[model samples]
Target chain A: MSKLLIEDKEVVIPGQILAEGMDYLPSNGAIREGDNIISTSMGVVSLSGRLIKIIPLTKRYVPQIGDVVVGFVKDLTYSSWFIDIGYSNDAVLSMKDATSDFIERGADLTQYFSHGDYMVAKIANVTKTKAVDITMREPGLKKLYGGKIIEVNPARVPRIIGKQGSMIKIIKDSTGCMITVGQNGIIWLKGPDLKNELIATEAIMRINECSYTQGLTEQTEAFLKERTGGKQHGVHQEA
Target chain B: MAYTKRLDGRKLDELRKVEAKVGVIKTAAGSAMFRMGNTIAYAAVRGPREVFPRSMAKPDTAVLRCYYDMMAFSGAGERVRPGPSRRSKEISMVTAKALEPVLDLTEFPKSGIDVFIELIQTDAGTRCAGICAAALALADAGFSMKDMVCAVAMGVIDGTVVADLDKAEEDYDKGPVADLAMAMLPRSGEVTLMQMDGEASQEHIIEAVELMKKSIKKIYEVQKKALLEKYGGVKDE
Candidate 1:
């Protein structure tokens, strides 16, 4: 009799058989091979009910709608700003999406957003031809200034934020730094001091390296306490 | 004629030592260098990134590109010369076809994954080494696939089926030689690549394929062990 050939969280290689006959239907990272279900990639398996899928250990970011990304300004068009969001083609940020204020046509769009500037924006739309449109006329979305940006794995962003913003909030409270996290794996932070900034950066790096490990939040918390020299500044206990 | 032994002193079915050194290139997305006896090849995988030339980008899947080259200093004795030779170009196409069956290109959709394999040293079975190393590098890059492909070559010498053909035994001008290369899914018994050179009888071909099937299981162990060393945390080690 055929059964689920792999256990939950089992690592599998491509073409490795997952099941025989029709006992189970194949899911992502697995395909039907003759009468058997076979894995077509290297990944950690996740079994949900009858559905079995594989999640890769590491992968490049593929754009999805509503993902807030940190992108570099590539060029300025007459009606829009072209941004490179790590894709092959440029994502367009139209002038109308940039500001509420109306400006005369061809009245220096660069005055609002120029080339080489980084911004945290949402992907408003992506077309069949891969044309993308972004918007910044939303709260907490704007042209970033006077801060250093760091890129992390997009998949691990949720872990960095922790459960209900627990991990990032701890880092923010410790350093007393302003930190904005973009879903595209771009982190913006301005710590009180360069040393504080370095500590926060290192903390994120730690998360990126070990996101799969258990007890990551506590480890990150301990890491922050140790890195800040244990001179705990209780910011949330404000009178 | 009673047979003595292989020139390298290995048994008819014995394979050479295999070492898979992964994450060798720091800059490439993923890379590995594999050595089988005297043959060594390095493979680097890049992208699932933007599709180039626009038209080549598939609306429903990703494209797989490969470049297999032998460095001028790879061969023994005199320099083999630089740039893509006719033989290298043919091998490039051959390697690409072999990898196509393994990669689930539809996952990336319009992007491309390029696998570059460089022959660092040669004895025999360089293509086999290259294909094996490329699979590891692709796994290191994290592309979705059915399975990693392991390759090995079989030859009939002195009326015996030998596992891996080294340089001395693969001489083309030599009499009564049958060199067949096979790349397969070790777990499923699916063939992704099979090429035969030199003259051989049908019986020898059938016998050689059986030998290849058994030997690649050993190569599969090596490939899996190498990947686990780097990504052991994801799966149970």
Candidate 2:
């Protein structure tokens, strides 16, 4: 007989059995044994019909194809710039995908993108050997200049971004800071001044810390309002 | 003469006081501290990131590397010499083997996960303590693991089989003491590590394994509690 060992949204640890019987299918951070579906990470259980998955509380960012990532240029090759997207290996951002500008071979690549330059790019492909390829040709993807970057737990990136960008939208509207959150958990914040950027950073960090709690959006909205103060034009006043 | 009484007054099947806490080191990717009686072990996990020396990087799966060390003042009898000794290196290897089974690093090819286990205090089972701490640290670091690996040192004192061996029992001169450090995957009841020192008969070995099986479950509970407390309070069930 099929049995569900855990309720939806329950916190589970590695090896904890989530369900029994072949009727249930395990996905994500969970795996299937002979007849039992067990968790393979320390995370919360997310149940959807016959599918059972675990949402890990903490995990290293695994770059996937088509993921928008913030990366720092580590080194420059003749035709490519090695980008560190907080992964095990450096990603390759070649000249063709680097920009729309036409360039000659070995034309001093540093003149375009140099060491220590951060850029918001998209993962174009990942080779079988785990070589990552990122691109900056897409709109809204460019080299971030003079903005502060802060890292958060990659797992919390979704919560920081919120439902359809609601949480981030609230923060942006209040602080008037341009916030770019990368799937790799690296955030770029550039505001009119350092104070606004700092406020945005603190709000993002707070969301990262308390991402597991309920009513996070409301808490964040109140927090941004309090920090930015109600007098600011960006701070929305309730009727 | 039969060794009837435990030196520390614990029952033959009873373990030392177990205490565990996760996220002890804020800087580590995952860190935990586990104390079994007087033996205290702190474990920190780093990476699934780039493998150093590049040549050592695996193309299909991530490498699990462990470093086991005992602090100078942690020993009960004498100060432990700093640096990686032959004993430490062996322990480190066994530790990696014990934890490698549950970890699924296939998703992270060309990466390396390093587990650093340090004994802050020692009373007999330092390696076992380190293993326990490292398992918890790996889980905390959010690595995919099949199950938590629990370890404990079971010893045969004279004719009696005991659960957790303390320093005094290890040093008991009145009887032949045989130390057996074992690690097991609790759910599967699979023994991942079994290293015996001194001497033991077939009957004594069987008895020690039985005691270990029972004690391992208890250790698993403690490890589970440590992880749950850090992530969220224990759910009623």
Candidate 3:
């Protein structure tokens, strides 16, 4: 195994052997001199023994091709809608990419999409200039309506949605709000009362803040009960 | 009448609540989030990459490119779209200039430094906050630099020079509102970045600059403390 430097700092980026005789290996961002492993990166270093890595304290959202994301309509043309996807530029959603069905010309474009409307889309392509072209022609991608929208840090959206949609499923089961999250930081929620909408919003915000914690489902359930003055219905009670 | 009144009940020379956190982004070379009261800015610095647009490359120094953006929701009621507007471009250019003086650019010949700052929340004084956060992130990224750059904004409000103005004070100040933003090299006392907006008498401008110098000194101390805490008092030269 060979040792290398990250940014000129002595760090053992996975697959580097620090010692010749011992099974113990230095973690990522760590220096192994003798039996001890020293941190070479400026972050909370984690060690799996298999390979140590540096876990960054902050998060940033980077768009990827073929990933489904929610976006907000900012500008409209006769043929397409310009969507703001929290990137350096707006992504285009041509009418052809909106749906496989043919859309009639001058048919009250608002019927298909109005400015400020949020929808789920897939990144079709990214140009050399980094301009992203998006399409709604896929399963589970469509226009969103009749829900109050809230914005959060784009980087935290995945955590807010939770693993395999478990976290969001809980929120939906509890608050009974038809919810949709766009990758661009727009969240849409529709509930019967202003109270339920506010409750759902608070739950999402809390999830965003406390994403690092374990037992998030239980914690969120308890939090919702305390805030709403009653236990949430349909909470998955695991035996 | 209280001699010190600039809304938010802060004194003429008193600063707003200042908070700084390091390592906000996992993918960036280095990152930081800074909040001056309600004005919150996040900065990420990634660098030592091959210079783009080969024509702009210089053999002697690293080219620094900065992008400053305000989140559409940063304002009170208006939602801003993410993109480079004229205002954002101007702020980005000024922020890049502020960081240029402290960086030992000669180290990375034909390379580039990319500093991206996003204003997650804004009340006022965003440009100064962006510069401060970007400088810290660059240091965190392990880039060699001459000194930490600390920035602070002072403004002439109601004929009195106030340090760090918030949104209400910035909007309502009746007198010739002059905003002076400066970035200083703590050890050298060198002004790396300086800019003033609105008209102020030369005397008032000088007074504002003096106030900024003092404020930036305090900011420098904060930067040092944060870095020391992260690296265990190991000074990076």
Candidate 4:
């Protein structure tokens, strides 16, 4: 009785059925009923072997473990700092998880992470209610400065990063901009000059506009090359 | 009584005309300009983003705010003022209520999903058209929902049950009679919103509801076509 109602990579909306029975295991965007697997959101259906799932078209950032995010320092608590990751609930950055050095218990929390500073941190844990705990103790994770952060659709972040970092590698080597993309649709770009920064930003927005299309990497690579006058024209296929 | 002809030359139960296009406003996440008969409504949806005014932020779910406006130039005769009035305010709330049941707002908490609908040219039944357009814009913005909502108005005109009444049919003098608007989830046959003014007998009300169900099925096709046209959801070869 188990059957897939949608083709591979077919677009589906909420409440649509993906399967009719228990033969297929449901994943993201799917809810299991007594014998049917139904879609619970608007997304593209993808089947991996026997695993059936749907990739949502629009959604909020659901923090996962080890996700890099751009967060704003919203408030300062007595013992912990609250970070607004642009999602629902604010994430807590305990003073203990702030750094490796032995900082005093209540020794100037703002000086460590102020109320207005922007930081590039990693999600250490995500609770059931979507409350995240971030950490700056990891390498390459710190408070960002002198750079501009732009927002795109978070659902398209995977295409922005490209497969195995191939797409981003082209962007980095081409523009010579220090680019870091967070899973939460925030991109931090720092370049030697504003021209390069603008180029990177425009490129990212273009990718965002057409993220769902095929051959996005080639289009992005070509866009960067033309904008930069082929100075950094080296298109590396996805690794 | 062979009075089957309507003022607009439609049958006793014929829609005027429905034309829609999504993504009209490039800046907004999703937007649409929809016209039913001569009444035109534009809807734009922008967000799952940060909520302004810290007080309105929900701790566990997202907030939906709708604003309905009627431009001064949209009316037929004299100029209408461009601002929010009591009528527009009420229409805004009812329009939001019609489509609210479709969206799963909890998916984005501490944020706001803002929808703006403007009645540029209204000749009656603008709120129903606005709700229909709002549903299209929401889908175009990629927000998932249980089912898309479709709406239509049914009224008794000249002692005849009709669907999608125009301003002429609605202006039957003697203090407007029995104007009913129904917004429903067509597939599941659930009415999420219903507004009635004027008067009708019990039997006529039942007849109007039945007539509304049929028109909704047609309008539902138009709504889905508009979404698929923008998003490329064609499965047929």
For candidate 4, list the clashing residue pairs, or say none: none
Number of the top-ranking candidate, with lDDT as the measure = 2
Cα lDDT for residue B53, candidate 4: 94
Which 10-residue window of candidate 4 chain B scores lowest in summed lDDT?
B227-236
TM-score of 1: 0.88
Rank by DockQ, highest first. Answer: 2, 1, 4, 3
Order candidates by lDDT, high to low.
2, 4, 1, 3
Tens digits of lDDT, candidate 1, B91-159: 888888887887766546677788899997999998899999999998777677677889988888766
Runs in model 3 with CA error above 4 Å? A1-60, A104-108, A213-215, A229-239, B1-94, B100-130, B133-221, B224-237
Candidate 4 off by > 4 Å? A1-5, A15-26, A32-38, A48-51, A77-80, A101-110, A233-239, B1-3, B26-29, B46-60, B79-84, B109-112, B174-176, B234-237
On DockQ, the leading prediction is: 2
Lowest summed lDDT window (length 10), candidate 2 chain A: A230-239
Where does candidate 3 clash, by residue pair? A28-A52, A58-B24, A58-B25, A70-A182, A70-A183, B72-B80
Say which candidate scores most in TM-score.
2
- Candidate 4 lDDT over residue span B1-237, tens digit each: 423577678887788888888779887777888899899999998777677897898887778888888888888788988778898889888888888887877767677888999888989888888998888888777675767788889997656788998887787774446789889887567898888878878888889989888988788777767665655565667
- Candidate 3, residues B116-188, lDDT tens digits: the string is 9999898889998999899878767755454577888888765778898788877763455767777776655
Between prediction 1 and prediction 4, which has the larger TM-score?
1
Q: Which of 1 and 2 is ahead in TM-score?
A: 2
Native interface contact recovery, all models: 0.52, 0.79, 0.01, 0.29
lDDT of 4: 0.80
